[model samples]
Target: MQQSLSRGSSPLALLMRGVSRLNLYLAGFSAFVLLAATAAVFCEILSRLFFGKSLVWVVELSGYSLLYMTFLGAPYLLEKNRHVAIDIVTEHLPPRLQMPLAFLVALFGAAICLYAAWYGLAVTLDQFQYGSRETTVLAPRSYLLTWVFPLGMVLLSIQFVAQAVACLKR
Candidate 1:
């Protein structure tokens, strides 16, 4: 399990633990979302070819599913060290040099993701206040989708922070 710097008897630790669990659960849901989206796309193609008609909703729904899947899985992936990496320089670096570099990079990632989370929260709030709706045919409230951006960003930022903490603990 991913753990916060504060292990026990602290509210922050509790919150972090909850966030870790949330990442896991959401990641699982993300997998389901991907499967459903794929099935929807396949059905749409079949409908177009066989019935000579299109499933208009599939395109928009699939787009949303893609967005959700990307965001939802990110935190868990980062926490588990399964996220993408380009280690050309790092792999070649001496072991002593790599630790500080990795920690710094993790800190940088945390800072950037945190800033994005803050901006995403602002946009989400604006959408909520203005009652914005997507201009798409579905006309769903913009918040329905906008909320996920901040949620994902927040989760990712926390995961990055956790990674940095782990690096330091090493």
Candidate 2:
């Protein structure tokens, strides 16, 4: 039988469950964003064909939507272990070493994600403080898009930490 972390009232287990739920919600939101982007593209194409003109904001909005979708979905993908992996070498290792190796790998991934989150947050805050805007006709605030990067990275880092904990438990 699978162990039930939810049955225990441990803070780490609770945190893991909370992060998992958040990731699921983010993934759903990302899917919605992707659909919106698809609709925008379709509308752009139809407008171009029928009216010989395209909406000025469609392309930019679509691009932003794609970016948001990627970032928002990343944590859920990581939590579900859906990210690409090359496990050929690791699979050959002895069974006893597998959990350690996985833990090490998760730790490394968490470190990278944390660094990315920190850097993204710094850039996002700078853009927000400076009132930076994209140099496009839409002229959207740069921070609006940049904030997603840090948010995703932070979530990814949390997922990695949860994975690392699971590896340790194993």
Candidate 3:
């Protein structure tokens, strides 16, 4: 009985640990993105003003980096349940109502993210199929840049499912 109990609890504990670690990883990645963006911006300024030339590539690259950073950070935010909520209604609701409302919200959010991932994947494939490339310097495939959206959203959707499960179990 004791062994069974421990084994049964272990999976949940492991899942929780993984989720916590994922949040830390996401936060770290976000910080790195921020630093990269800052550096890129600084370099852009230096190249444009001091060198009397344009660092047009830096602007484009940094813009994409910013977008990636925002998406990558989203899953971490979801895990922490740190997203902004109006709370006007939730704060006033009873615990019972709150629980159901939270579940429904999570379900809806997960569904939306799942759909986004599907659509993003399709769009990325299309770009890849067409050999689309950026108009600016480097001219890397546009599909590579577009991939971040689907991947990040999928991860976020998974995180929300985990959160919803935890909430229901509680």
Per-model C-alpha RMSD: 1.8, 2.2, 4.5
Candidate 2 matches the true fold with a TM-score of 0.92
lDDT tens readout by residue for model 3, 59-130:
788888887887778887777667666779988999889887877888888899999999999999999999
Expressed as tens digits, the lDDT of each residue in 113-170 for candidate 2 is 9999999999999999999999998999999999999999999888777778777767
- Give lDDT per model, in order: 0.87, 0.86, 0.77
Consecutive 10-residue window with the lowest summed lDDT within model 3: 1-10
**What is candidate 1's lDDT per residue for 63-93, written digit by digit as tens?**
9998899999988898788999999999899
| RMSD over all Cα atoms, model 1 | 1.8
Candidate number with the higher lDDT (2 or 3): 2
lDDT of 2 at 5: 43
> What is residue 164's positional error in candidate 3, in angstroms?
1.7
Give all TM-scores, in the order shown.
Answer: 0.91, 0.92, 0.82
Which portions of model 2 miss their true places by more than 4 Å? 1-7
